[model samples]
Target: MQNIWSIFKRELRAYFDSPIAYVVITVFLLFTGWYFTTYFFLAGQADLRVILGIIPFAFLIITPAITMRLISEERKTGTMELLVTMPIHDSSIIVGKYLAAVALLIAMILPTLVYGITVAFLGDMDYGPAIGGYLGFLFIGAAYLAIGTLGSSLTENQVVAFIISLLIMAAFYLMDKILIFIPNSMVSIVEYLAIVYHFQNISRGVIDTRDLVYYLTLISLALFLATRAMAARRKR
Candidate 1:
């Protein structure tokens, strides 16, 4: 636990030490603010449905940027050897790095609170759906970050990592739309596998156990894959 915390601090500090965190956060806020403001003025609604609709696309770009250099840069600079030599499990290292990414995401999400607060003041707002939307974003973001971490683990080049992660995430994000080409029998299977379907379900304010399980399973699987990738590197 201590080792994980230390690694978390180190990785989190690394994000701030460079321009990566600032650039990602700034871009995220700018885009989200634009989308939210545009919808807020046009719709005159207090709901966050517009903003929620933008999140998947925002994450598709932002998450890859956040996780591009996580492990890839370590290996590129030859620090991965030193990291693996530490007296700790690879899972610890993966989780520590993954958590740092998640923390950065949380920071990005925090500033968006102003949007919700503004809506509350402008009109009658139902906090239930808003809260549920935030929860959905957090869970989905964690899964995406885990996937990005796995992508980073697969290569030592940051550009490759970013591209790999972006492709994977884009596929998942577009799963629902792509499922239209499949037969009816396969629609249910693909729908169940699509993250956006579950995200929408939870965003509607009804939290189903199946949706929770889907996200947790995806997150665990991605993180497990990342840990295994690191372990394989250690063995070689």
Candidate 2:
């Protein structure tokens, strides 16, 4: 626990000490804010649906960039060996790094709350879906960060990590969209595997156990893979 906290603080501090956090947050806000404001006025809707709709797509870009250097940079700089040789467990290292990324994800999402507040002031806001959208975004973002961490653990180059993470995330993000091409027998399985399907379900303000399970399962599996990757490097 102590080791994890130390690593978490180190990683989080590293983000703020450099321009990475600032640049990523600025880019994310600009992308989501532009779409949300544009659609909110054009549709004359007082709801936050526009922002909710844009966030997941924005994450496809933002998450990879944020996580690209987590473990990959450590390896590239030859610090991964030093980290693994320490008394701390690999899982602790992964969890600490994962939490730092999650913190940044939260930071990126926090400013967007202003969009909801603005919509509320304009007209009656459906708090149920608004609340659900934020909650769902957190879940989806955590899952993507975990996947990105796993990708980072696989390569020494940050660019390769970014592309690897992006491709895997894109596949999951596009799964439900491609159901028409899938046979009827496999459609259910494919849709069930789609990350956005569960996210959309949660965004409707209904929190189903199945959706919770899906997200938890994805996060756990990805982190477990990252831990294994770290373990493999330790063995090597």
Best by TM-score: 2
lDDT of 1 by residue, 52-146 (tens): 89987799999999999999999899998898888988999999999999999999999999999998898776788888899999988988999
lDDT against the true structure, per candidate, is 0.91, 0.93
Alpha carbon RMSD to native, model 1: 1.1
Please, what are the lDDT tens digits per residue for candidate 2 over residues 1-236? 99999999999999999999999999999998888777777877776887787788999999999999999999999999899889999999999999999999999899998988998899788988898999999999999999999999999899999999999999999999999999999999999999999989889999999999999999999999999987887576
Residue 145 of model 2, lDDT score? 96
lDDT of 2 at 206: 94
TM-scores for all predictions: 0.97, 0.97
